[model samples]
Target: MGMRVKQLSQLRNRIVVITGATSGIGAVTAAKLAEAGAVPIITGRSASKLAAMRGRVSGRCGFYELDVTDNADVQRVVDRIATDFGRIDVLVNNAGFGLFERFEDAPLEHFAKMMDTNYMGTVRCAKAVLPYMKSQGNGHIVNIASMAGKLSTAKASGYAATKHAVLGLTNALRAELAPDGIAVSAVNPGPIDTPFLETADPGGGYAASVKGYLLKPAQVADTIVRVIAKRTPEVDLPLSAGIGIRLYGLAPRFADKTLGKLLNRK
Candidate 1:
């Protein structure tokens, strides 16, 4: 364990840029990365939360108030980071949200907003950083998707669509950037215990049902930190969840009747 910590600490001074980083998995990952001696540059839509996170993180840290949907602003921030930090070694696209409601009941605007922030926002950030990472000849991009991306569940249709897009991007980008020495990885977690549920499941039904199974933010953060070190291709949290996803993939019709019904808590 000491040797492992030593190995992880080799990231001293490494610049890691994370989006949607003021809370939840993103926020925890920022602190963990800093603990490993890396410089975490956190971005989020909330200035006060960003400031609070900056204050809490140890070692060198950077916090920016950002809305992922703003392409111009994203580019500006990316440019500024590249200029101020000199190089961005890692990018974690964790900025996203979900709203749970039956397809017919959910507002169309909510779907648009989710798509812009969750899918297009990721695209924008990746595009902004690609030039710098490519020029540097190496970098890593870790996208935070969800199990919903792999297995569609009821009441989260819109949210699932956005994550599906992110997963697709992660896979294709991984293959495209391999030769450039830049790595792309996808972290698909199951239900997480965070403020995310407040927004995704405002009615509290889904959260209540999945109470026992929700993964902790710190646990997911540890996985993110490990992915940074290992440059892993893809990771599905909670061994059981991954198994469920695989089973669903193999027998969609059966899963639709069994696992799908069980997962339609929202």
Candidate 2:
């Protein structure tokens, strides 16, 4: 673990607050950060699951029950964390879910819910942590966006919109926070083998079609850990997916005919 140690050296004793951390990528990240000597503070809607995560994570791991959609709750939790930790070194906004439904078939409430939870939830948490980070003179904010934000496909218009908002917020915050010694990063990962797929594609057809390309939760968790250490601006995973996003941007017509058609499997 020499290479791993070198990568995580900067994180020793840092306090990392991770939202939606009871399972999946967030869960793995908490454990990995703990191994790197960072104090991992996990949050989720389920108090029971949060306790379980604290037990599972190595070393000192704290947890809080958080529902990011609630603005007051977000402020309360973040304040409590800051008071306990003295300073918040990093915040990973990973609390989000997706649903795949055609624009015409999807209910308006679904889109609103996604926007409220995925986008506004991030806004609330980021705002809550600002004063603490600003006072400390340094901090990192990592938002777990998605490839769909860049390249929207069929049956995911609502979900894609939410991710797109997250990406936009991340980019703007990076610029705004630079002078304050704060770094913002966006992790745009493709499909990962996690409960996320279960919610996004309940039928499992999309997962079945994309099985070979699906990334493991740890793969994304590792990237999140690295980005915190390096403070990278943006990271798009799975070289192939990155290539497709680039190709789509460069030649939309050609990509739509080839890559877009292939990816519209959902």
Candidate 3:
């Protein structure tokens, strides 16, 4: 009897900020949130893309050119949003990327860039917005992680590290912010066909082997909007992927052996 789909429409008037909203899952999610009646304030690195996306979403959607990794830029935007909207009911930390290469062959700069944007970006945004969300005594933060966060995969060590960091942050924040009526969650999806994986080289056979299981960016967006409106602590887009994570989490060595087998088939 708790708030179901019919009652979730109460979020229509909420001010929600979505990062990385120019393209990929973030953009699609921005549009969907508009449809669901939330005032979606979308952000990305490019002002042009944000403007274009603002024109595309359905409801009261705005755009902010945000570089999430930069602390000053993040604080500037968070302050701006609080000043303009008075409150941010939701913050979606979906701005992140990854490169693919063997750890030995990979350039240190690329890995550094990944951690800065993926891990530091989430941390900066959460810190910047915590006071606002805390003062309001109610808020939700949804971090778009990946199945990679829960398992080891070839050529994704850098990506996995960032995502794992995010998951850790989400869990810790959830515990710390519980009494404040704030909710923190990590949404982990498997193989969503987004620009996150459009690196120069994947350097892994696993990705190439299973091209069909990939979901679209819009699909991931659908699940994310659901997370925003509901108080779900954790959501795995595909139920099967959740089961797989548990299986691998239970026996990492066995999972790695199976991964080798799967890759050999490639």
- Full candidate order by TM-score, most accurate first: 2, 1, 3
Worst 10-residue lDDT window, candidate 3:
198-207
Model 3 has how many clashing residue pairs? Answer: 0
Q: Is candidate 1 or candidate 2 better by TM-score?
A: 2
**Per-residue lDDT over 162-260 for candidate 3, one digit per residue giving the tens place of the 0 to 100 score:** 888889888999999999999998899877776666652455454566677778888888888877777678988578878977887788788777766
What tens-digit string does per-residue lDDT give for candidate 1 at 63-88?
Answer: 88878899889999999999989999
Clashing pairs in 3: none
Provide the overall lDDT of each model, using Cα atoms, as 2-decimal numbers.
Answer: 0.92, 0.93, 0.82
- Clashes within 3 Å, all models in order: 0, 0, 0
Query: In candidate 1, which residue pairs clash?
Result: none
TM-score of 2: 0.97
- Report the candidate with higher lDDT, 1 versus 3: 1
What candidate 2 gets wrong by more than 4 Å, as runs, is 1-4
After TM-score superposition, what is the CA distance of residue 19 in candidate 2 from its true location, in Å? 0.5
